[model samples]
Target: MVDESMRAALRALPKAELHLHIEGTLEPELALELAERNGVMLPWTSLDELKRQYAFENLQSFLDLYYQLMAVLKTADDFRDLMLAYLKRAAADGVRHAEIFFDPQVHLGNGLDLDTVMDGLLEGLRLGRERYGIGGGLILCIVRDLPVESARHVLELAAPRAADLIGIGLDSAEVGYPPSLFADVFVRARELGLHCVAPAGEEGPAAYVTEALDLLHAERIDHGVHAADDPAVTRRLAEEHIPLTCCPLSNRRLQVVHDLRDLPLRKLIEAGVTVTVNSDDPAYFGGYIGANYEALAEIGFTYDELKALAADSIRASFLPEADKRALLG
Candidate 1:
């Protein structure tokens, strides 16, 4: 069991969230509200019914439900309200800084325009900073399941509002769609001076993580727990101090690990890699970043270990070092 002291320690430390999906923050209650507002009829009529569906057999199982709920997100207010709601929860959980991932390609597939998605999320991020004092930015994702031209089109749209977005990422199904598929996408984003990160080695192989680092030149790896599967890559990640954004709760919900104790935090840490805990999808997988820390504590994480993870979080973030130090203080 996690003691109150361990929980308290985690709550007191301000940390950065580096692996969150903005859409994954959509709670069942908020989903229902948005559905009603947008005049959409959801298959799950009640909140409890939707909650029951949150349990997933695997990553794709969860993605199906996650994308289905997003049908209600038709207006800018829906998106802004969604962001504010998540920022409030994150702030309450002691998130002082965050880099949120958004799937604009998925939104576009839903027949939503680029401006509506970007404008509302940027507005909500602005409000999150003003209202919650939570420093944040957006990283638009390229869905690997889509064609390269679709991603290129999304990038073109991103160019106009490049100032509002800080980075580009590859998300959605990772099995067949390798990081190498988006190599040129990252090259263009890097040329435009946007930070790059990729979700790899979670459901895919550790080699994919190396591909992301070597080919895509991703600054950080999201849900990189499976990188522990490769000794050489793991060692290099340790020696090079590559940050692996680990999401424990999401791993369990997605059946990445059958047991919370088997989450591989210790192995990654022992290998000398800078591992930071985050809530990939709070509402669906259950719990925010604080609860992720508490889960680690329950599995034998000490106060110092928790502190180090918190520190690693800020260091891995896109924030300036001076700002990082201030947040650290």
Candidate 2:
């Protein structure tokens, strides 16, 4: 077990959260509050009932509940409150910077305009920076399970506010919807001067990692644990210095690995791959970024090794070079 002193030390390290989903940070208490405020009818009556559905057998199971809970977010204040709440928790977890993810298409489908979503999230970011000094931007993630045309449409709608985003990412169900499917969408995003990142090899094959790099021009691979399955793919990641944003607790909670010991974090590190720890969906997965570091420590990562992971997180972030150097020092 990790001691209090060690946990305190881990929490003191300045880090950047690279794979967070703002919607996934909704806590049960806040969810109920928003439901009441927005007058949205949820199937679950009490916070206890809502909390019970956090158990998941797979990615789809989690997403089903994830999208359902989004109904409470009907106004600008709701979105702003959600982001501010996440930033507050992230600040306590030593998040010096955070490139947050938000699904605009999903919000749009809920009868909200793009302006409302962007305005609220940007306002939240402004407030977060003022309050906590945490600096970062958003990565508008494309829901891969939806129609490719919908993916294209969101990119089109996002073009006007491209400057507000740090990057574009491919997320949601990863198996059948390969990176190759959104090749055009990513190309357009690049034209808008956006960085690229995609979730590959969590539930998909290691080949999906290659496709993300080659086709989508992904700068980082999210949940790339499966890349270790192929030496060639792993070698490319190491040689290219492409980072993997691995969420240990999320992997275990989602049954991506039956046990935390089964995660390939050590193997990936030894192979020269740049791996950083993060809390993909902290609230649902049961930990924040600090908890991820502590879990690694519990599994035998040394103090210096954990520190190195913290440095990796800052290095892998989308922060400006000078800003990154300042944090690294």
Give the winner by lDDT: 2
List model 2 lDDT by residue over 58-138, tens digit each.
677888889999989998899889999999988998999999899999999999998898889889989999998877799
Residue 147, model 1: Cα distance from true site in angstroms: 1.7
Local distance difference test, candidate 2 = 0.92
Each model's lDDT comes to 0.89, 0.92
lDDT of 1 by residue, 54-156 (tens): 8766777788898898898998888899999999988988899889999998888889998998888888989999999998999988888999989988998
| Clash statistics: count for each candidate | 0, 0
Question: Clash pairs of candidate 2?
Answer: none
Measured by TM-score, how close is model 1 to the native structure? 0.97
